[model samples]
Target: MSIEKHDASVPHTGVGSDLAEEPIGNPGLPAHTWRPTDVDDGAAKRAERQVAAMFVGAMVCSVLFVVVYFTAEIGDNQDVFLGLGASNLGLGLTLGGALLLIGVGVIQWARKLMADHELVEMRHPAKSSEEDVATTVAALSAGAEESGIGRRPLIRNTMIGALGMLGLPAVVALRDLGPTPGDALYSTIWSEGMRVARDVLGTPIKVSDMEIGDLINGQPMAIFEVDEEGEPLVEGVELYVAKSKASVVLVRMEPDEITPGEGRENWSVDGILCYSKICTHVGCPISLYEQQTHHLLCPCHQSTFDLADSARVVFGPAARALPQLPLAVDDEGYLIAQSDFTEPVGPSFWERG
Candidate 1:
């Protein structure tokens, strides 16, 4: 064995080096050890069966996943355990089991049956030669034999079945994306007379409580409602989804500094305006505010919107402006929604016009 070194002072950018060291002699290959599957027919057969079992299990799980997906009523079903919907639980478990079985099958195949060898290839040209190609094919054939893939039809069939089953979950999940909205993107939970409230807390905001240059994050009142007994009205995944869609940002500036859009003159009071916190580009939450410019920036894609000018897209990848939530004062003088958002919030979707 020999060590090779390069001089520090040399400008070695390309293949040629000013102070290149000599090459070291190659070390001989280590002794090869045969796996139990390779030497023992019984062990090989057992391993094949094990791999086959995993694949069979994976396929069964995939079928169960489909069954769960179709049978589970995801919305308004009201069956809850540990704060999780029963439908969601069933779907997740079946899908997870399917994936896990496939993974374990592959791991077992590689560990107990696949070819295990040690080979040394000399460093040659960057491109492969005719001999290299021929050798590669031969190596693959050898590997297949050593792995007992061709010999063990059961394992091969099972692995193939397991791998094929993986596609079912992906295809089924795609349906959850739903039919493209022709105009759903232009709407939101915001509606006339809806009050703006602190998310989860459901507490209304007073215009006087907000100071100049203040930025307050909020959501729709419906998202944070309670039962008649003050119990949380919505729980689990429904609450999560509602919270995500209804998020908003409230900013207070000088009343004279605002430039409200046409037909939106009364949307603000005392220089306080509210807009969707979600970004228009990829639906990232926008909260980084520049108090002086009244500009909001999305942390995800760096999309910037100028709030003073109808929340217009100022810079970055966002194709549209932030959706504005019209604001009004209730008899109590607290900020309330004059209406829900005029447009949908978050990433551009086909439903959004």
Candidate 2:
């Protein structure tokens, strides 16, 4: 529709019956309020200096972050603050300060030195003429002039320096992700005679201990083991690493109820069998068990496995069965792993087919 538009501020622009319309009173702007930096040249200079100081501070923090990343030790017994490790604490604070100061500096520059006058834009036809395009380019140029970036050499130079230094920490952090985990997932600490122990207490499970339908979470005893001199066999990160691969679930069912796969008919003890507790799809713990059907459910994505049938994936996203741990009874009648899993367990990756 090519109809004429009416405006209260410019009623003469309207024609025909639009003249009798009431004036849509101009809410003119909320009086030209001037900031201290806008009215006083001295205050403006101080604001510029303050913004520059913030940028300089950001650069300093970024440099300190790199220094701490190399110099600090992140050992188990390293210095602690309220409970956090000192290396982690220092790096976190410095990087956080670098980011925060840069943000605050940019905000101060915009609020204190950028154009403060308000211009009301009117509603009109969507298409713009060549004159309107020229007016927009001129307004942007005026905005750039009012922002004072060219005249404020100190703020402009320091801001550039601050932005340049921020990338240093990210490059330094890339080093931490290195040292690949080649062939580490192929085997765990579970050897032929290593006893299946209670997860934390290291209590060995005897063949007579569990009844049919009973399920117990277990791990290789070597993780909680003590040396001949009574020191821990594995501690800290090493202990966690071993536990991740050696974790398992022990379930007992009737021999008639089980369906052993291929040559693995003798992998279980009495009515009991053991499988990795870690799920095949992304390594979530498989805890939800239905003893009746011998189905183990991974709570993460509902991947179900038929434990009786060699832990085969009966449903969901897992590409393979839960890896089974061959079991036996030591002469002492305690449950032990016959050997490490025949193949790698848990989630697969490009390097592991």
- In candidate 2, list every pair of residues with a backbone clash: none
Model 2: per-residue lDDT, tens digit, 1-353? 01334454653322222225434543442455778988899999999999999999999999999999888877766777777887899999999999999999999999988867654344556898797789879868977887788989999999999999999999899889966678888988899999999777789999999999999999898887788999998998889889998899999999998999998988999989999999999999887899899999999999999999999999999999999999999999999999999989899877777
lDDT at position 162, candidate 2: 97
Candidate 1 wrong stretches, greater than 4 Å: 1-166, 169-187, 199-201
Q: In TM-score terms, which candidate is top? A: 2
lDDT of 2 at 20: 50
Q: For candidate 2, what is the lDDT?
A: 0.86
In order, the Cα lDDT scores of the candidates are 0.78, 0.86
lDDT string, candidate 1, 148-168, tens digits? 777778888887887798789
Please identify model 2 stretches exceeding 4 Å from their true place. 1-57, 72-118, 122-161, 170-186, 198-201, 206-214, 228-231, 235-241, 254-258, 262-266, 269-271, 282-284, 299-301, 329-333, 342-344, 348-352
